[model samples]
Target: MTRRARGLSLLLLLALIGGLTALLWPAPPPIFQTRTMPLPGVLAARCDEFTPRVEEPAEGVFVAIGYDLANTIVLRTSAGNVVVDPGMDLARAALARDALLARSPGPVLAIIYTHSHIDHVGGARAWISDGPPPQIWATDAFTGHFIKQYEALRAAESRRGEHQFGRSVGPELLPCTALGPTPDLDHAGSTGARMPTHTFSGLQTLRFGDTEIELHEAHGETHDQLFVWIPARSVLLPGDNYYAAFPNLYTIRGTSPRPVRAWIDSLDRMRRLAPEHLIPSHTLPLRGRDTIAAALTDYRDAIAWVLAEVLRGANAGRDVDSLAASIGLPPQLADKPALTELYGQIDWSVRAIYGAELGWFDERPEQLYPQQDAAAREVAMMGGPPALLREVEAALARDEPRWALHLLAKLRAAGSPDPSPELNIRALQTLGEQTHNSNGRAYLLEAAIRLRRPVAPFAVAVDDELRAGLPIDLFFAAMGARLMPERAGAAHESISVHFRDTDDHYVVTVRRGVAEVVRGEPLPGTPTPLASITTDTDTWKRLALEQDSAAWALLGDHLDVDGSLLDLRRFLAYFRRGA
Candidate 1:
C-alpha cells in the first residue's frame, strides 16, 4: 500500500485496458468493390417506344412522338391547325412543327395546353405560324397551380427533377426518360412559353373549321389537367392520364398529393367517351374502340384497387411499409401492357396514398422522434463501422441492395468514410439496373453518379419572358424559404419591395428566427423599414436566384435602393441561394 506501489498498480491497469481495446478494435471496411450488371431488358424495350417519329392515327391528326418527353399533336382542319401539348422546348417543338407542316400544313390557329406542366406548354411559340398569334387555351386552375409549385419549392424541385430525369447521367445509365427522351432543358427558354389566353372550367366545346373539339377539365396527374376530345373523329387526347405504363400515382420527384379519387373519376369519364383513336401526350396512340376502352378500364381499376387497399390497410392500423409491400395490381391489370410498371410502380403509389391520407406518423412511438445518434452509438457498440460495412457487403451479395444502402447510409452518417462512396454507388447502381420503373432507375443511377462526382446544385433557368409572367409574391416566398435564421441571428429589420413594372408593393420583416412577408403597404402604425427597394420583376429574380449580384444591380440602376447600401447588403445576406 505504499504510494510507489499504488502508482505501479495503476500503470499496470492502464496497460491492460489499452491491450483489451486494441484486441477488440474493428477491422477496416473491405476494399471498395463492385460487379457491374447489364441494365434490365424491359427498360431497353421501353426505350424503343421513344424512337422519335411522327405517326398519323386518324385523318388530319398528326402526332409527333419520341421527339421529346411529351408528344405534340397537330389537329389539322380547313380553318387551321390546332396544336395540342407542344413538346418540351423550342428546339424539339420546332422539329415537331416542321414534321406536322410537312404532312398537314397550316397555320396553328389555336394552341391547346392539356395542362400547365412545363413540358406541355413550354413550346407554345414554335407551334404558331407567321400570322396573328394563336389563342392559347388551358384550364382556369392552370396559372394558380403552376404558380403554387414555383412559390417556395422551385429550387428543391429543380434538384429533384434533375435526378428524376437522369440529367447528369449518361445514356448507358438512362436510355430515355420514362415518358420519353430526356427533356431538352438546355433550349427550354421562357421565349417558347405562352400563358393561356382562353381559360375554361368544367367542359367547353369549340367548333372551328371542320373540327369540333371538347375540352373537359379532368383532374388526374395535375389539378389543372384536361382531356381534348374530338367528337367528329371519335379521337380522345388524355394528357398524362393513360400512358402505356402504370400511371404515376406518385412521381419520385416530389409533388403535392395527386388526387387518386379524382384520377379514377377522370379515367371513368374517358371510358364513357369510348373514343376509337386514343392518343396520349406520351407514348404511341392506340386504335380500335374496344381496345382503347379495355385499356382505360384496366388502368382506372388498377388505380382504384390500389387506393382501396391502401385505405383498408390504413384503417386496419397497418404501417405504410406493410401496405406498400402487400398492395399490388391484380394480375389481370398487371398483365395488361398499358398497366405495366414502366413509369410508375404500384408500391410507390401505395405509400403515397397512405401518406397523403394519413400524415407521416406511422403510429409507432419510437418513430415519433428519430434516434439517429442512438443508432450511431449502437453501431459503435456492435463492432463499429467495419462490422456494418461487412453486413452491407453481405446484403449486396444476397441481392438485398436496399438493405445494403440502408447500412451504408448509417455508416456514412456515423462519420465513418472508411467504407468509401464506391460501396454506396454500387448498391444504388444495382437497384437502378434491376428496377423496371424508368423514373426510379434514373433517380437511382443519378444518385450513384452524384456520390462518385458531386455536381453543382441544379437550378431552373429563368428567362426574361418567364420572369415577366411570374408574380412578385413568388420572389418573396422564395426569399422566405432561403432565409437562414442563423445568418439573421438577433437582427430585427424590415424591408419593403416595390415592383415598378407590376406596380405591386410588399414588405418583408425579418425577426431573429423568421421572415414574414406582407402584401400591400405597411400598416399605418408600423415603424418605417430599414430599406426600401424599387426594382422590376426580372431584376429581383436575378438577385434572388444569384444570377446577378445585388451590388452590381444597384450600380447598374436595375435596383433603386432608398436606404444605406450597407443595410441593403446586410438584408440581402440573410437569404442564401439554395437550401
Candidate 2:
C-alpha cells in the first residue's frame, strides 16, 4: 500500500482505541455526583448545646442520650443486649449502661468498639457486672493500636487532651456542646478498655439471637475502625466515621496519618447499605434511608473535594502552606448542617492530606536541617522580652486576642520574666472565649489558668489491669517519641531493657541527641551497650510511666543492672518526665 494510505489506516485504528477508552473510563463513582441538600440554618447555631435524651430509633436499638462527646449504643437483640462504644470513662459508661438498661432490660451479649480510641472503648468495664461478661468484639488491630497511642503519649496527650475537649474553660466562659454536658479533663488517660474476646480482620457477620449484625472494617479516623450494620433493622452505626460535622480528617491534638482515600471508600460502603436509620458515635441519629444516603454522600464528596484540591496543588509542585491557604469546600457542601466545621476545621484537613502524601517536609531546602523554634527566636531578636510584652498588650488592646496569645506564647518560650501575669491571663481568657474550636478554647483557658496560678503536675491515671495487659514492645515504642534529645548531653549511649516477666528484650539507643527504641536484642557490630537492666514488667511500667521515681527504683533494688549504673542513670535522665 502507498505510505499515505497506511497513515490513514493507522489514524482510524487510533481513533477506535480512543473511543473504547472513553466508553470504559468508568464514570465518577455515584458518591461524587451526589447533590448537596440544604440543611437547617439553626442547626449550626445549636450544634454546641448538649442536652442528653435517650431515644429508640429502631425497634430494639436504644441510644443513651448525648452525655459526653461520645455516645453509647445499645441493641436489644433476641439473644441479649449488644453495646457499642460505651462512653469515655467509668462514670460516663455507667450512666449510659443504666440509661440503656432502663429502656431495654436484658443480659449483655456483646460489646463492640468502632475503633481503638479511648473515648470509644474506655467505658467497656461499665458493661461488665457479676454476670458472665459480654463477648467483646473489635477489629484485630484495636488492642495493639490502643496500647501504642495511650502508653506512649499518655502524658503529652493528657495535657493536650484537656485543651482538645475544652476542659480548661468554665461553662460561663466556653459552654460545652459536642463534648457532652461536662468534659473530664483529669481522666483523659483512663483506659477502661477490656480485651476483645473475639477479633476479626475484614467483614464478619455476628449473631445475637435471631438478629444478624454485620461488621465491616474501614480505616477513616483510626486504622482499627469498624462500622456495624444491623441488617434486620436496616440500621447503620458508623461510629466516628460519620458525625454531624466536617470529618476530623486531621485532629490538631496529633494522630497517625488518617487514610483519606480509605475514609472516602468507607463512606461509599455505608451509602451502599442504604440504611433506614443512621447513628454515629457523636451527635444525633438520622431517620429515613434517603436522608442518611444524602448525608453520607455529601460527607464523602466533601472529603473527596478537599483531597482532590490538595492533590491538584501538590501535583503542581505547590507547597502545603499554599494548598492549605487556597483550598476550601464548595459552598454547597460547606453550608450543609452535617458538614459543618464545628469539630474539625477545613484548613487542618488540607494540611493533614498534604502531610500524609508528602510527609513532614514541605520540599523546602531550608527545612532539611533542624532549626531552633522560630517563634521563640523571633521574640528574642525583636527587642527581647519587654518589647514582646508591649506588643502583646497592644494586640490585646485592639481586641486581637488570638494575636495577643500568640505574642505571649513567644514571650514565654523566650524565657521572659513574667512582667504582667494578670494582663497576660486576661488576654488568654479573651482568646479562649473567642475561639470556636473546643480544643483551641481549652488550650487558651488552660494557659490562662497557668499564668494566673500554680498549675498541678500532669499525671496519667492508668489502672493496674490495663497497664499490666499492654505488650512490652509498646512500652519501649512509646518511649521513642518521648525522648528529650536536648537533655541527652554530648554522649552516644545504648541500653538494653530486658523484661523478665514477658521475656521481651529491646535496645534503647541514644545518638546525636535522639533516642530510638528497637525490639529484640542489640544488633551485632553496633556500639556496645553501656548498660542492661533486667526488671519485671510491673517495675518497668512504673519506671517508664514515672509513677515511681527512677532514684527510688534504683535505691529499692527493683531492677538488676549490668555494666555502668552511671550510664543507665544518665540515659534515663534524657527523657522529660510528665511531658
Candidate 3:
C-alpha cells in the first residue's frame, strides 16, 4: 500500500481507539456536580451585620446559620420551616432563624444536619419554639461517635491540651495565637460541642414550603458527614472536608486522627459536581466552578501532599519533630485561599499522621536495642540518695533547673524512706518555676508533683508505683517536643523495652511514694529458671534516659536474661547515661 493510504488507515484506527478510551475512562466527576451549589449572593454576600436581610423570613427564604466551624442551612416556607445543620450554637441558630424570618415569609417546618459534629448540633434549640423541635436529621451513628469524641477529648485535654494548643494557667503560658480568621469563645483545646438529638443514613429528600432538598452521605472529615444538595439552587455543602483551608490533615487541637484517604475522596465527590459557588462557614465564600473546584482540588492535594511527604519521612524513620518540620504544601496548594494553613499547620498534622500510620518505631537498629537503665545503673556506682541530692544542688547552682531535676529524680529513685520528700518537692517546684514554655511548665510541674505528692508505698499502691516510673517511649514522647539539648536526653531511644503486658504495666511498684520495679520479667520471653530481675517501664525509662540503671537495681531489682551475665557486660561497656 502507498504511504498516504497507510497513514489514513492508521488515523482511522487511532480514532476508534480514542472513542473506546473515552467511554472506558471518562473524566472524573466534578465536585460541583454534587448539587447545583449556588453562588454566595442572597445569603453569603450579606453575611456581615452578619445578620438577616429582612426582619422576618417568609416562605422561600433560605437562611444560613453560623455553626462555629460548620454552617447550618434554614429554609422558611409556608409549611412551617426546614433547617439544615441546625448549627453549632443555639444563639447562632436563633440569630440565623431570626434573620431568615426578617427577610423571608414563615416558620421552620423541619431541620436537617450535614453531619453529627457538635458545631452542627449547637443550634437545635433555635428551631424549638414551644414543644417539640423540628425533626433532627443525622447519620444513625452520628450521635454515638459525636458523644464518644466529646468524652475522650474532654478528659485527654486537661492533661494533653497544652501540647495541642499550648495554653496553661500561669505567666509562663504563651498567649493564644490567632489560630483562625476569627476568635472563638471556646479555646482550640477546649470543647464546645453539644450532642445531636436526631440521626439518619443513606439518601433522604424532603419537600417543604415549595422547595425540595436532597441529602447524601459523604464520609470525609468525620465518619457521619452528610452532604446536602439543592437541585433548584444548584448548591452543594461539602462540610469541613471542602473547607477554605488545607482541611486540617490533623487538627492540632487533637481529635480522632482523620482518614487521609477518606478526605481525598470527599473532595473528589465535591469536584465531580463542579458547583458554581461554595460557601463554607469559616472563610469567605467562593464563586465559579473553576475557582471552587480548584480550591477543593487543591485542598485535597494539600492534605495528600502533606500526608505523602510525612509518610515518606516516617518510612525513612524520621522523628516527629523532623517530620513536622519537613511537611510543606506545594505552590499549587500553598497559594489557594481554601487551602490556607489557618487553623492547623502541616507540622503537627504530620506528626499525628506519623502517630496514626507508624506508632513509636523508627525501624532503626538503635531503636531495636534499648538500653536497660536499671541494669546499667546497678553496674555504675551512682547510688547514695545523699550524693544524688548533692548533685541536684550542684545542677541548681549552675542554673540548669533541668539537670537539677535529673539529680532529684535519682534521689527519688534511690527510694530513701527519709525526710528528703521535702527536698524532691522543692526541686520540682523550682523546675516548674524555671520552665519558659507552657508545655514544659505543665509537664515538668505534673511530673514533679507526681513525684513529690505523698502516696502509700509501692506494694500497697501498685498502680501508683508503676506510674511513678514512666516508660522511656512515653517519657520522651511527652518531653520530646519540649527538648532543650542542655536539659533533656535524646528524643529518640535506640533501646529495647521488654515488659510483661499484664502485671500492672502502668505502675512501677512504688513503696512509700518511692518507685520500685518490684515486678520483674526475663528479657526474652523464655521459660528458663528463676530470674526475679524483671524490668518495668519506669526502670527502663530511667536506665534508658537518666543513666541510673545501677542505682535502680539497688533500689529495685535486676537479673541477666537470655545472654546471661556476659550480655549485661556488653551493655556495661556501651552504657553512657551514667556519668
Q: Pick the candidate with the highest TM-score.
A: 1
Query: Positional deviation of 26 in candidate 3, in angstroms?
Result: 54
Off by over 4 Å in 1: 1-36, 185-191, 369-372, 458-463, 523-526, 537-559
**In candidate 1, how many Å is residue 393 off?**
2.5
lDDT of 2 by residue, 206-283 (tens): 987889999999989888899999997999999889988788888766777898999999999999989999988887
The parts of candidate 3 lying over 4 Å away from their true place are: 1-71, 76-80, 150-154, 158-198, 314-321, 368-579
Question: After superposing candidate 2, which stretches have Cα over 4 Å from the reference?
Answer: 1-49, 151-155, 186-191, 316-319, 360-398, 402-427, 481-501, 507-518, 526-539, 542-579
Model 1, span 283-325: residue lDDT tens: 8899999999888988889999999988888888888888888
Estimate the Cα RMSD of every predicted model relative to the unseen true structure.
13.5, 17.6, 24.1
True lDDT of residue 263, candidate 3: 73
lDDT of each: 0.76, 0.71, 0.47
TM-score of each: 0.88, 0.80, 0.51
Model 1 error, position 136 (Å): 1.1
Candidate 3, residues 1-579, lDDT tens digits: the string is 333432222221111000000000111111112212232232222223232232212224353533233445555545766666665444555666666655653565666666655456545656666755556677776755544432313334333432333222222222222111111223221222333445567778877766677777777777777776666665666666565445566653457777888777777877887777565544445667697777777777787788789777776767777767767877656666445444455776777788788876756666677664653364246655556667777776776776765666554455445446655555655654454322343344444444533211110111232234222333322211122233212222111224544343221221222222222442332233311224554544333333343343433343123323332232222222210
